[model samples]
Target: MSADEHITQRNSSVSGNDTKGSTEYQTGGIHDFKTQPNESCSFTTLKSNTDEEAAIPLMVGDVHLAEAQELWSTVRDKAVKLRMDRSGLGSQPPMTVHQMFMATVQKFGEYPALRVKKDRTWVTLTYNEYYQHSRAAAKSFMKLGLERFHSVGILGFNSPEWFIADVGCILAGGLSTGIYTTNSPEACQYVADDCKANVLVVENNKQLTKILQVRDQLSYLKAIVQYKGELEQKLANVYTWAEFMKLGENVPDAKLDALINSQSANECCTLIYTSGTTGSPKGVMLSHDNITWTASAAGHMIKLKMAEEEVVSYLPLSHVAAQINDMWISMRIAGVTSFAEPDALKGSLGNTLREVRPTRFLGVPRVWEKMQEAMKAVGKNSSVMKRIISDWAKVIGLQASYNTMNGVSSAPWGFTLANILVFNNVRKALGLDRCRACYTGAAPITKDTLEYFMSLYIPIFELYGMSESTGPHTMSWAEGHRIMSCGKVLNGCKTKIDKPDADGNGEICFWGRHVFMGYLNMPEKTENALDADAWLHSGDLGKHDKDDFLFITGRIKELIITAGGENVPPIPIENALKEKVSIISNVMLVGDKKKFLSMLVTLKCNADDNGDPTDDLTPQVVEFCQQCGVVASKVSEVINKKEPAIYKAIQEGIDHVNAKATSNVQRVQKWTILPQDFSISGGELGPTMKLKRPVVNKMYQEEINKFYSE
Candidate 1:
């Protein structure tokens, strides 16, 4: 055979003898443990200075000099390493998604790879079957003339088919773009057109209807493949998944082998669109090298165990956070991933958690907040004895969490008793008994919420990253974490604060192999995001302590500047206010060029009926009013009337927050409660439950104006 054909043949089969360091598992499959390159493929390793002792300079601005220096004095000599080396993990990183997938299949072929709900039962896909099915899908794409470097769009909720289609496109040497399932048709059209995707795969008839609405505008769209449901309208260029897979039966494996073998690590593999809080979403181009390096680095930071970990897939696949944790990192670690039912996530996530008992779980701040709220409700309704025990356990847990955050190992005898009496049951009830690591990111989580979970013996780590950095750049690891800190930079990543203000807060900039290639077809925007030296300007204001833990203050553009010219970061104040007052669902501080700071607040309303607030309020809402000694049929009435009792409570909450404020500009001068809460469907909140500041400000402009006028 010719050299090219030899390479193609070697890549096609799972024969152990052909590849170096290939081990034959007892389960009757070949697993390659070494990071060997195919004859036609090459890989790149990120450069690092592992052995050098770099100076730990205090990068503090004038405003933070005293505090920074004081913190620095404690850990200047014994601080944990800020930048860990990937090489120190004792393994060569896989270069491409295909490489990682093949290695995982080789290592755990008979092990369950994916589990999905089928009617009333769960269906499992083993590693061997996953690889074979992906190959089949790739063959089908090749039959459809999917050329190398072309783009394919996947629009759907988290499902096993989504994972199959994504890997199929990558294995076929085409880049895949995921469109948010909750996005409007116009938004979907923008992503499909901007990426120039030739084929779009959607979940069901509803998703297909979205494509049909905008199909006329998609010039490059050649075909639409539906993973579920039959052909309803019989539109042109629409194919059912069964039909698509049948198309692959005629195509040979050699074609896919050659395609996979020709791939390079430096090439772009995926385009993840931003959430578009500021403007239209930008397509972030991420190379295979970026994903692989991030997976390896993050795995090292969190110490993910291979074949011993499981994770639930519920977060939108369009988001990079889910992609990294559920797809890339899982593949790298050869771990199992279970898909949550599409329509049942909100009602069944807790049940699913108990069923899966995932060792690693990733949740946004909202999910954690809901869990905390549920715990609070349970505590409220429990008997006096249970409440006392819970409170006592919480006190012990809080102390234990504090010690853990400060890197101290000792715990009092009461802590062990509390763990057995209350904390352990709490963990089991939340289905986090087996969870080794729980992470919250995508937005800032309140310190109160973090400590609440910690008191339950479940430490929730805060991670920081964006689409431009392959999901996570900094994360609070298990060994060394601090309250309110996003932890140190990940292994193989470098972070710096640029143009710090007097308060030492500045735009958080990062440089590493994990940085994205650039925004798709938007060179000017990409240039604005990345500087000449390749440091990504994150557009987030943050500060770092002497121990190298990162603390995000707020968004640079969202900072509220008072008429007196004092700049106030709203996030900390908003978080503090929410922590103090449980009823305030969302808060947006306003005072840009105004005399004083004011806020537009929204109340948390849980009606007994989903659509009828007048019918009855939830027990928790009623209990809150009763505890405060306010008599009202609806929580909205108290807020709308600004009733003296509730108003006094709110004012006391605000005053308490102001007491902790460092300056008068940071204090809330006034606030007005909205009739309803911010929600994703209402456009006030992003898909991840992050408040869209611009949208919210415009929405309550009239209410905000009234506050200033009064």
Candidate 2:
């Protein structure tokens, strides 16, 4: 036979039933089944590129792959080699994403890997089925002309298709990029253009419109696939999910196998765009090693058990935190992940949580805060006797939680009774009854929110890291965690406080395999983040406690400098003020280049159907006002009338916070209540609800100037 004919014959050897067959998509909801242990399904094993491969692409988009190789090799040669005995980097050899997935499938082929709601039924996909679908998707991507080192931008919420597309992209030797569902058409274009996306997979026609609006500008975009709803327009190059999945049915298995085998652990496989609180989003390039290694190490740190963890995936997958929790960590430990409803943040999340009863839960600070507010509202409406009982139970619960956190062996009196009477019911109501661990991160969480949850016997631990570190560097867990600390560093990771002050607080730096392969196409930024020693310099300011617990103080960029050149961290003061003032919802301290610190405060108010803050106060705030003898129902009434009781309470709270300040400069000399609360729609907050200080400054520039002018 001729050489070309021989290669073609070899590629087509695998039968259609073996390579292209798919599990029947089930309708309605099916509950999770308990299959016998040792029940397993077959998974294909691909050739490992053990030796250096010459076929690996030299360039990915505008990034030179060799540059990343040199950078990580230096760290591997220096720190990794020297700390071989102590650090985790030395213990495990590097592996690609394919290897990690194979390992998981081998151990948990029959275990449920994903659960999606269809009508009222919850349908599940086993690990083996998940792998098979991803492979089929990979073939389709290859059939669509995806090239090596190119990208597939998945723009959607968390779904089965999202997971499949992401894994499929990586399997086909292309980069997987997630675009925030909230991104505008222009923003979508920027990411698509930056990643040189070969295909864009959107959740619905709404997102499809975004890509279509900018499609003319995206030179590299080859195909568009909508995972939900029918295409509004039957344009050329646009395909439905069904059509897209069928494109590669005729493609040979050997075609995808070749690309998978040519992959390396050191090369970038995914891009996580920073939410860009400080500026425009930058693509954070994470290598295969970064994802697989961090998944294993962090999973172990949190004590995730194989097939035992059940988690809700609702947060924006574009953020590294959600991606790690919903995708990587679950994949690593062979856990079941259920996708939350599309309106999760809009209030459907509670219903999903109640149904799933996840064994673990992760929420941003805002989510926890909202839950706290909802619970408080319910408590206020309870009968007199019930309220008395709940109040007593909460006190006992809080005391017990504190004792356990402090490592004191003696349980508080009535602790078990409190757990039965109040704590268990609270957990069940919030759908966290089976949760072994509940975590909060992506922004600073107030001690008030933490203590409130502790009062309910649900202590929310915090994890700290950025997109560049591939999700988590320091984590807080159940066994060994301080109330406000971000916990100790992960086993294989190292942290350093650069140039500490008298209190030992400084910029936090990370050294680990989790550090990303630099920002794509931004060399100056890459140099700024990773110093000469290869440590990823987190712009976040933090300090270590005597017992090695990590406490994040503030960010270097967020620090406010006075005219006298004294640096002041704002969050601590803001948190303190909010705690003291029950009616206050949000506060931002402003004193940069000023004589004294001032603040812009927002009252707790009801949100309209559109989620915009209305003029009316929330129920909790109204109750607070009633207690203060104010009798106000709206924020406008309190502000326009200058209600004495309300203003007096605010003054008292400010005074209480100022009394604890170390210096006169730290005191709030002047303050004003914003007519409306800061919100994501208002452009004062990021997608994860993190405060955007720069945006806030610009929005409230006129109000801020009034304080200085006086």
Candidate 3:
């Protein structure tokens, strides 16, 4: 087969490294950047020398820091201007999702589209290639007689077909459903039955088996299309991916036109089944316009213009976060967005990364925390070579933290010396040297994690948003982030405080075109979410400074109501604890409707940064506990001493919160603080990382009862 023939013919605009013409732009599998040629033209590397700050005088080149920043600045200005212009178009004006996607693709067609490389061989489906795939997939869906509002399911991890299936469904006027790869027989059955999809696309044997198990339960499924090699797990009545493409290639062009003509901007494009925090998952219906406009607005903030550059995408499709960054942004901006190859996210991430050299990467805070932990692990390890690397990393971290904190990202000559001596090897190993910017959301990340990334020259700016808002609200686009705030509101997005506690923080309501039309069949929910004035009642408490940067405090429902009717934001205390110590993982403030403010503490620190506690831990964890002035229990020396510093802070916070309240609201009683960390898999926190209070209180009924009981 010819080199081009080896490439997967999926959406061209969807992948980040799919350029026109093969030039070793693809790889066979993970750990093979040494083989592929870059599709994007050579942008000069940013240079580094010893004057910046380093143990050894080292010179590093090809990063192109100033050039990258300049490009981003121009894009940012354009995004802001376009958003302001569109702001006048009204909150609910309509346009097709396909139109938004195509417009962007036309703009960035020359850039590499999608880069998927494994082991040795690599394939990039460029913008033109991606476009061909979408057109064909849409045509095939039309030939299959799918009607608008009908449902189609795509089940797998991040991949090219994931977007192909999604776009095909939407372009054919059908609603798309995404299933988590981790779904069990019952979960698969539940989603299939609930969404009532007519066609389902499976990645391979594992996900296909899930469909097979629930085949009896699904009444609406008429077609099961497989995207895998068909080498594993036999199945019947299934259309191979190649056959599906053939159907499209053979279809008359007139029918393809009809498919596009049939689609409406305001119609439901995707039925995103939210990974529910409570109860069974519900399908959050987002219109093409809802998501398209959302992408339009969000794209502007991150400068996701359909420019000639690469963006890395490895987020899960089941959630709104990935859908927006990977699909919606690609659809609206028109650039090559790469997917992390299969289950080999970390490995594939490194390989594909070298191939694509993406400018922007949208990640969850957990990923950032993991990166930070990995660095610290390497730095603090006993290995002689690792320790040497760690010493250099400490220098890089210090410089990065200083720059990120001061917002002076331009490096002096000293930091230049450090990069060559230290940061280059780390950057190459992490495959992050090519990254221009990284946006982290979904949950709160330690400032340390953010600084650690920025120090390595990958600025991982954090943001906050929700599914109802179509994605982000407050995003840290620029440098100099206040230690307290998430970042400023994106351009054209507005915020207001409904009611503030003694602190300026209140339920953060948003007003913008990005806010969705409303909840799909639940009118009451729709009404509650979109208030009379059209401002989205975000239900999240936050405060913004004069500069418009937003600082999220806590959830309104989550505000721990003290015994004296004193309202307290638990997140501040929880977050403050995270910044202050190492051994503590999660700290939940209790004492709502109780005499005094108490907290339940969960331990096992490395869940985010460190892997399993059994596999790895810092020796300093024990020593750091002592330095923080925490003492192990007089009764049990084994208990982590770090627990008390957090416990003491919670007690002190009670006093701080009470100072603003009346006499009745003053805090005065005992506090119960435990020594265990809450977990998501173990059912301590929700997937979004919020404390499952009932779970915490139930599991530690003894600890909780000690303070409140007579």
Candidate 4:
């Protein structure tokens, strides 16, 4: 029998007796639903008999044989559309991360696999070189006595070596755990100790310093491997990149291949730590099957063409989005993955984008926002004719965007003209002319921001998922784009709304092969996230449209209940306020169990031409402040004091927004100007730039109380 046939036969036996009422079959805590045996086999489902008469007895509960067959056919069609071929006729079944890497190397050994910037020079690595170097690293790990299921911590910015080290650990039959480069020593130690990592990989001396600070706390850590920079201290078990690779020179490739073959899809491959917006970070265990499935499904969704697709890797590799896009998906499709210079990304991502002109770009909302700001800054100084042309082009582009979002087939003549004369140039200037697909996730993006990019002929698909869901549960597919929705659920994934309210908003739940295994060493949390029925409760409140597109409203835990017994979703209101007020940096709606809603607002400061902080406020900036009734002479003063002018300006802005509120309880009754903006360093914003509401509420309890007291 073929491998696929054998897998089906094995699953049929493991499925046990067909329980009449059971909706799912449990095997080692993972549920596999029953499908028609003739249909393509899925790792997520069990095959049944194809004969109509014989299959009748296998139907669950009231499901008729015909109905079951029809349901299976529908699912099979969706999988086929997603290019998920389990029979391996046209496409191969999902492979583990290590297997995928090796397969890519075998097929595209001479093709450029990775590009990195080193001291103003671009360095390229072929698929073969990447494979050889990673194998060497894996051998070195084995030489260091690292065995199967052992954990290794990778802490650094995105780099080519980072990918090598990550895949090396997997090839050695070990779990790779990523630590955010921005994490403090305490946070680093927590992750390393919790995962019981035996080896720690650091990028440079700075990262090495963090490890040294918490070295004594990580009793399980045996070795430190530095990929860059000279070691400052002669500590035991310390090995530089050159030294580490040297340890594996005598080791055989057969040894690494044996270890890779020993790994199973069901075993844990990587431990991704959650951003911990609410509390301490928990290691989310994602099995090889979970990752490979996600990579395959997501790659299919985007329709990435092999050898032609390119992506810039800049986001924290610790984040699942970056890991999946830059690491897994790139490997899955044999695409080029470029590593942006860490320091350059903060101030000059545009330059890097121009240099790479990547075909596929994935960024968070902040990146899009910064690009918009830069464009606006240029427009502010442009000639009158240019401004007029730009504005007219945007009007045409907006109509086209609106038509696309509503599923219209044809665009007006003006859209074509604008695309040729204005939008196309704008795209080229932003280095997005070659970009075929652009995505934004990790946090909520405002509709205004999404539309703005859409107007520039760059459609930004807003996706929704968490660390527990591998990467993406729902994404705006190019064929059926939606303006504000998170698009339809991916193939092989099932979604349902639990306890929907009057507006049809409810906690979003998911059941699929891409759902993570569990939280490491946190069974209680895992049990809470994954129920007995196998549905993963997302804790996020959302509503699905008539077309089945999902729209996330807000976090269930962040929902505010007023003293007047009115429930308010703060995200929409906050998003609206941000759209209306440009100078507002951040706004937090606060009124939980209170008589009325209020907010804490922060102001954006003006910067000089060199992007340095400046005390001088431009005429436009001063005019905006004045329009809101603020009387600050300098931009810096807006955050320096609680002046009457600032309060009046804030109140004016609030009153303007309140006029559009649907209910009295949703309107802001009071407001305050925070002395500073919420930041990641301050513990008010998560790594993804999402506001940590609980942390913010606790830090400003006294200020919040004063607002309520009045």
Write down the TM-score of every candidate.
0.86, 0.88, 0.74, 0.86
Task: Give the Cα lDDT of each candidate.
Answer: 0.75, 0.80, 0.59, 0.73
Error of 4 at 669 (Å): 1.1
lDDT of 3 by residue, 1-710 (tens): 22232223321111111222221111231111222212122321111111122111111111110111100011100111001111122221234666655654565565566666556665777666777788788888777666657778888767787788888787776778888765676877777777767788888877787788879788877778888767264455578888777766777878777767655444456776755545576666665555766665565555443454466667678778878877776655555677666633333456666666666777676566656765675566558876765566666666665666576757655676667766777666776666666677787666656656666656667777787667777677655365446776654456667766565666787655456544444556666676644556777877766655677767877777876777776765665555555545567667778767666654444333222223123344554546657544321233444356645655565556445445544334554434445555556655444467667767887887776776
Q: Name the lDDT value of residue 330 in candidate 4.
A: 86
Candidate 2, residues 1-710, lDDT tens digits: the string is: 11111112111111111111111111111112122112222322211112222211111111011222134321211111111111122223445788778877887899999999988899999999999999989999998999887899999989999999999999998889999887889999999998889999999988998888999999999999999989888999999999999999998988788888777666788999987767778988888878887887677777677778999999989899999999998887889999998878878999999999999999999899899889888888899998999999889888888888888888788988888989999999999999999998999998999999998889999999989889998898888799889997876666778778788888888766688877888778888998765667899888888888889999899899999999999999999998888789889999999999999999988776656678889888888888888888998889998889898889999999999999998999899988899887787877788998998999999999999998
TM-score of 3: 0.74
Q: Please list all clashing residue pairs in model 4, or write none if there are none.
A: none
Span of 10 residues, lowest total lDDT, candidate 3: 63-72
Q: Candidate 3 or 4, higher lDDT?
A: 4
Query: Considering every candidate listed, which one attains the maximal TM-score?
Result: 2
Winning model by lDDT: 2
In angstroms, the error of model 4 at 301 is 1.4
Tens-place lDDT digits, model 1, residues 1-710: 11111112211111111222211111111212232222232333322235332211111111000111110011111111011122422123335678777767776799998998888698999999999989999888888877676778999888888998999999998888999887899999999988778889999999999999999999988889999989887878799999888878988778789888766555677889987877889888887767876887787677677688899999888999999999988877778999887743355789888888899889999899878888898898899999998998888888888888777889966998898889778878878889898999998899889989888878898899998899998888788688889887876566767777666777888756677777777768877887654457899988887777888988878888888888788998898899998777778889999999998877666632222223234466667778778776575677666778767777888999999999877889888877777777678877677888989888888998898887
Model 3, runs deviating above 4 Å: 1-94, 104-110, 143-145, 229-236, 243-251, 304-306, 343-356, 382-426, 451-459, 479-481, 596-600, 605-680, 683-710
